[model samples]
Target: MNVPAAPHSVQPVRLRISYRSPESLLQAFTKSVGKGGVSLPSQRPLARGTRFLFELTAEAVAHPVEVLGEVVDVRRSASGEYFLNIKYVPGRSRKGLDAALLKLFEAHRHEKSRRYPRVPVHLKAQGTTQVWSVRDLSRGGAGVELETGELPKDARLGVPVLLELQLDTGRLMLHGAAVWLTGGTSRPKTPPALGVEFGRLGLETLRALDRVLVLDGFPAGPWQAELTFGMDAVGRMP
Candidate 1:
C-alpha cells in the first residue's frame, strides 16, 4: 500500500517597511504590531481608551499603511504640546508588521556600522537660481538649509535636483534628489532643510567631492560597505 503524503505548511506573509530613521521605525512597529503605542504631538484632547486609525506614509514605500490604535495615556509638554500615547490593536496585520520591524531594525544596525560619516560644512550652493546653505556633507548625501519658502513649488520626495557648489578647487554640479525634510510644525528645533541623496557619480565628480571631503577632515578612503540593506528592506515590504 502507498503511504499518504504529508501536507505542506503555509507560510505567513511578511510586511516590508522602507528604511528611514530609527525613531520612525520604532513608531511604525509600535503602531503596526499593537504591543505598544507611539506618542503624537497634538493639541486635541483624547480620552483614555479612545480608538483611532493612523496612516503611515513614506517615500520608499509605494502605498500608505493604516494602523488601528487605542489611546493609552495623555500628557502635556512644557512647550504646551499635547501628547497621546497609543496602543495598537491586535489584527491580521500583526504578523507582517512584526516581520517588517525586525528587518528594519537589522538594517538599521548594519547602516550604523557601514554608512559614510558626515562632516560639518558651511558651503553655499545654487539650485535653479535659488541659493541654499549646505550644513553637512558625506559621500552619500548632504544636508542643506532652505530659506523661508525657498523650497520649490514642485519639489517633493524623490524629486530630481541639480545643485552647483563653489568648492575651493572649482565649481561642481551635483545631481541628486530630495530624500528627507525637516522643519515646519513637525520639527521646530530643526530649521527648514532638505536631505539630498546624490545620484551615480562620474569619475570627475567623485574625485572632486573626495578632495573636498578630505580637506574637510574626512579620512581619504572608501566606506566599508554599501547601503544595500536599507534599499533591500523596501522591496521586501508587502
Candidate 2:
C-alpha cells in the first residue's frame, strides 16, 4: 500500500531572508515557503531539527515578517548550494507576528512615510568617548555609525552595553546589544555601522521614543525585542 502525502497548510511564497542570531545577521533567499514549511538556500546549513528566528523581507512588502522556524530537511542544489527545509512553529509569538505583518501590508498601500526622525548627537561607549550619528530610533533599537576600529575588538553579538543619548527632551540612558553590523567597502568608502536593539528600556523612555516614531506618521512594525540572536562566527566588526 502507498501512503498519502502531507497537505500543504499555507500558500508558497518566495522571499528574501535575513537570518539573525547571536553570531550575526546573514542574507539568503527562499526557494519556496508555506504555512507548513519553507525551503531556503543557505551557505551555512544547520543540522536537522535546529530552530531559529529570521526576518522575511520582500520587494513589495513594506516590513519584514518575523518567523521562528525549525530545520526539517536538507538538500543540495545543482549549483552546490545548501538548501534547508524549515517548518514554522506557532506559539504565543506567532499571533503578534501575524498581526504585525498584516499592519505592514495595510501601510504599504498608503503613501510612503519618512524613515524616522534622526538628529546629530555625541555619545560614548566603552572607556573612550566619541561622537556618533544615530538614526532609525525606535523603542526597540537604533543604528549608530562606526568608523574603522570604532567598535571594540572584543564586542560581540548580544553583549549588553550602556549607551547615553542626548535627546532634545533631555539626556537618556539606554541598554542594548549589538545585533547587526555592516559597511566598510570600496563602493561606499565610508565607515561601517552597528545596529543596537534595546533590552532594558524603561516605561518613561519608551514613551519618549514613541513620540519620536509615531508622531511623524511612521507606521510601527515588529521590533527586535521579540527575537533572539544565535552565535555564528563572522569576520571582525566593520
Candidate 3:
C-alpha cells in the first residue's frame, strides 16, 4: 500500500493597515501568525512571548481598533530590515483597532468628497521641522504638490506631519522619521524626492489608506511600500 503525504498548510491571510500617531499615519501590509517576539533596537531585545500594546490615536482612536498583539515571529528580511510577525489576542483590543480604522475610513471618505489632496514629490533640503502638502496619495507613495510658501526643509516620508484621511482612519500621534526623497528625470545635480516606508500599521488602518487611494481616482489595486535603507547587522539604538 502507498503511504499518503501530509497535507499542505495555507498561509494566513494578510490584512493591510494604516495606523496613525499624533504626527502621521502609516500604511502597512501584513499577515498575523504565531506568538512572542524579539527586537533589534539598541541594548534591548523584548523578551520572547512578551505581549505589547499599540495605541492608535485621533481617527484611529476614534475608531474601534487598537493593535494588541503578542510577537510570534522575529527574523530579518533579506535586505536586513527586522521582520516581526504577531498574533493579536482578540477582545477589547480588537475592538479598539476596529474603531480606530473605521474613523480613519470616515475621514478618507470626507477628504475624497471634496478635492483630492496632493503630497509633495520632492524636496531640495532637510531643514528642522519640514512640511509639505500631499497632492495625491497611493498605497506605495504620494505625489506631493509642493508650494513655495509651504516648502519642507526636512521633507521626509517617515517624518511626522499632520496627516488625515476620510472614513475611519485614525490620527497619527508618535514618531515619523525620514525615509527618502523622490527622483524623477534627474538633472546632473538634483536627486529625486524622498521616499519613506512605514514599518507598522494596524490591519484596519491599512484598509483606510487603500480606500482613500481608490477614492482619489487610483484604480483599486495592490500597492507595495518601497524603501532604500537596509541594516546588515542589528544594533542597539543607544
Best by lDDT: 1
Q: All candidates' lDDT scores? A: 0.52, 0.46, 0.36
**Best first by TM-score, ranked:** 1, 2, 3
At residue 217, candidate 1 shows an lDDT of 18
TM-score per model over all chains: 0.40, 0.35, 0.29
Give the clashing residue pairs of candidate 1, or none.
Answer: 16-237, 16-238, 37-86
Mind giving the per-residue lDDT tens digits that candidate 3 earns over 122-233?
Answer: 2112223433334335454444333333334445455543233323233321112345565434432443344333335566656666555433212212211221112200
Q: Give candidate 1's total backbone clashes.
A: 3
lDDT minimum window of 10 residues, candidate 3: 229-238
lDDT of 1 by residue, 1-238 (tens): 1111222223211223453643354344332342235666666556676665544444443334545666678788898767877665544243333443344445545565537655444554544445566666667888777665445554567766555554545556566777987775566666678887888888888888876553321221111111111333233222
Deviation in Å, model 3, residue 122 alpha carbon: 16
TM-score of candidate 3 versus the correct structure, residues matched by position: 0.29
What's the true lDDT of residue 231 in model 3?
29
Give me the runs in candidate 3 sitting further than 4 Å from their true place.
Answer: 1-47, 63-65, 68-94, 108-238
Q: By lDDT, is 2 or 3 better?
A: 2
Q: After superposition, how far is residue 81 of candidate 1 from its true place, in Å?
A: 45
Give per-residue lDDT, candidate 2, residue 148. Answer: 45
Cα shift from native, residue 61, model 2 (Å): 21
